[model samples]
Target: MKNIVAAVLAGVLSLSLTGCSVFQTLEGQTEDKPNEYSNVYELSSGKAYVWEHDGETDIRNDLSQDRVGDPVFFACPLGDINFKGDELSDIDQYPRSIWIPSDIDDQIPTVTSKNALIYISDTTVPEEIIFERFADYGYSIGVSNMEADGGGHYFITYAETDEDDYKYYVDMKSEAAQVTEFDTIARLYLDKVGGMEVNEDTVSDGGTVMNLEKDKSYICEFYTGTFYQDFKLKANIHSFGKLERFVCHDYEFLHANCIKIEIPDWFKSGYYFVQGVGLFRYVTDEDLLSYNGKAFDPGINWNDPIKQYDEYGVCIFDPSLDIDYEDIENISDPGLDESEIVIGASPEEEEETEGSEIDESSEGSTLDSDSN
Candidate 1:
């Protein structure tokens, strides 16, 4: 009787050890399974390509110059810019005004043909900085040379917002827009800030670029205004530091729909956004000549030919050759994969074990028959 009892106990112990070994082997197989995600690079002929790198995928249009996206229409800080004739009246004292010439003098430093318009603003900026209105092009260009003190400064320009056709963009801020169709070259000036967002907390005071990490620089800032009267969007831009084929490469342009403020009311200002490039503090009129290195013409026409091209000799406003902007979806963030590990026995395995019937060929069945 003692030997039979020892044999039964030893058989049961061996089966238990075998079951644990099988479970461990199954777990090890699961852990060795290949990851589902893999790197994929798909090129659509030569126009565009989808590249997956380090678990992240990016889709870019290789030929993004043939088409231009429509501009976001926000009210200019000057409200509706009016053409107040050629001269500034001594009696009419406005806060901010500038004389933009349709015909300028190369030597006289004045409007030669007396074909000038006065652009007056009431909402933003000091008298030192003025916005030149390009009537034919239907936009305003502003520049500043002020330092970024505690209050901050900005240089920004945009298309006309008061036109009845663009009433849709009057109140839009921080919204996504689709480029349904290809636009003309004339539309480039109007398409300054595409898909841009400016919140009330936008920081204006430019931070130190040296303190920033590699390949990073200050873009723009949105901060609460002085006396809490208004919110400010200050953009510090530098243009053409590097010569490149595309104007987009000259400066880091942001695309977002703004919120709260209709126009960026720059108080303390520096830098300027114009001709698809951000100008630094000390920009002269000669610096605003042609896109490529055209000699400075003092009599440069503000609206002679609205279209500007890059050094690559391609139209700046041109969109991609094959793909449309509507088809390209905006991907703000990348999706991350998650995994879970199970310990001991899984719930399903435990349930199966609890409900399992005794096997007739097993030692347990033999032990039961012997007992009987």
Candidate 2:
């Protein structure tokens, strides 16, 4: 059976921590939190979660559930995978809502309209992640942006036909581009890519197919709304792998299900997905050909394309063990200048220990990270 509804996307950004033990539960990390976002922080195997803010739509309210599963833990596969977290001082440094593996069960505190109470766990529950036709998949409300010059970039969704309609879609005369809002651009792109008149109230469900059965192929229209881009992809689930654990970097995701999707015999690229986590891994025939001693890109003649699908495979987060932060500040002060704030270390402590040797970074550090 298929369920249809409006869906949202929340991109996953892995956090970089030093050598830390796997899966460290933060007991009192939220003790000093002042708001719901800070107070309800969770510690899980997720390194870090990065997402964009869409309109006032709360994804949890509009989540489509074909089965009695936890839709609140939905994840999207588009965001700044390159997002760098300077320090883990403030819990609000990340997205409003997050999913963390936990053993605690209780009524969650109410978050503001701008915040979401989305949480997830790696525990394998009886409910399955069902993919339906026209239903809105749950993830945090991720928003995308269209450049002022009519240039649009998307990840999860690609154009079905190579039409130069992007120039026609944009109104160069207006100060704000014709495709300003995320939904407007998303629908327009979806109409072209998914080959459906998304503007129309009723859409034709001609090629929509999704049962999520292993080794079974199904043609489906997948929609993605992430921080950088919001669009749809029309592809076939070539095969569904058995539910297993997906370990990336220092974090491990339990009950991780894999789905192999492709664009039939045309595109030579492969997209992979996890049940709870959206698109986690991707592969390409070009890289495969090059790995097998074939010229992948003749122009560039790039042989070692960073990854050859064998060394570590395609996991979302980079396996490097380095901490990175970019213009990080307290969530409350948006205009505050970026400072070098370390987790569990105050300004005075940082200054005092500037030249002194400190202990190594570990999972049991100050603040734990979360995923979408």
Candidate 3:
């Protein structure tokens, strides 16, 4: 009876070990499959391509003009505009193509030129469904400046349709290095503006607010860069709870050509604490009080009331400034105090003023105050 009992115990132990081994093997296999399909391709032009499979067919071919199942590539023309297909070292490298899922109900990729619009129908489905339905179809897509971070990578997809209208979609995947870099720059700017404590862990939410402001600024800056010609940041003040504002001045030769942007109020002030002291301190802290011969008064209000004339348009403050309710009534139509105004003098002007022993007060008030 004792021998029989020992035999039963040993048999049970052997079965348990086998079950443990099988479980581990299956888990490892599942993990390995996804990694196997993942690929990263680097082109000669300092651009990188990263992709993961959704269980679709993997084939490489050049169909540049055909527009059927051919891979499409997108990039910013700020740098090089040429595509060097021969320099790409990957054996599977192929010209970029537009990707279309076979199962999409619309049978066509949604496209839009408006930067504010988002395409959702194709991206919301399961990866397997997207692959089985769309990837099997010959729709190759092209995207530019794709960014990824903790949230995910986003790429704008553009496809040429039979109707000559280009369809746009945003393709998302795992966050990559490029997205992280932009996030870092944005966080740094927020730290400068709001003194917010941001690190990798808290960045997603904290960085999002900063990103929206920066994106708006970026758009405004881009427009300024293109249309306003030679505009530069003059005085920028960000306050808590809808009291944020920034000013830009355009210069031509030795005169102030125009005042470009005047953000009246910032909307995200309630989310963070921005004291008037911060803005005053920033000016004094940066020692911007003395640019050329002119000095700025940190105690006075920074809002400009003069509606100056410029060739392109009336130089007035941005209407968004009305969002700040605290001092909105007081600043509704504030005028520029010429005594408090500071004109940036050139190096030559500085040298001339220094040589002549002129009084600093007289030089400070020489800024042109004519509204025209």
Ranking by TM-score: 2, 1, 3
- Per candidate, the number of residue pairs that clash is 24, 9, 28
lDDT of 2 by residue, 218-324 (tens): 22222334332333321211111111122222222222221212111221222222233333222244444333321111232221112111111212221121212
Write out the backbone clash pairs for model 2: 5-135, 5-136, 6-136, 7-136, 20-363, 85-324, 85-325, 86-325, 99-120
List where candidate 3 sits over 4 angstroms from the true fold: 1-73, 77-333, 336-372
Q: Rate the local accuracy (lDDT) of all candidates.
A: 0.22, 0.24, 0.22
| Candidate 2 runs further than 4 Å off | 1-178, 181-269, 284-372
Question: In lDDT terms, how accurate is model 3?
Answer: 0.22
Q: How close is candidate 3 to the true structure, as a TM-score?
A: 0.14
Q: Candidate 2 versus the native: TM-score?
A: 0.17
Q: Looking at candidate 3, what is the lDDT of residue 177?
A: 12
Superpose all Cα atoms of candidate 3 onto the true structure and report the RMSD in Å to 1 decimal: 26.4
The deviation in Å at residue 318 for candidate 2 is 33
Residues 22-98 of candidate 3: C-alpha lDDT, one tens digit per residue: 45555677431111111112112222112112233221221112223322321111111112232222221222212
Judge candidate 1 at residue 258 and give its lDDT: 11
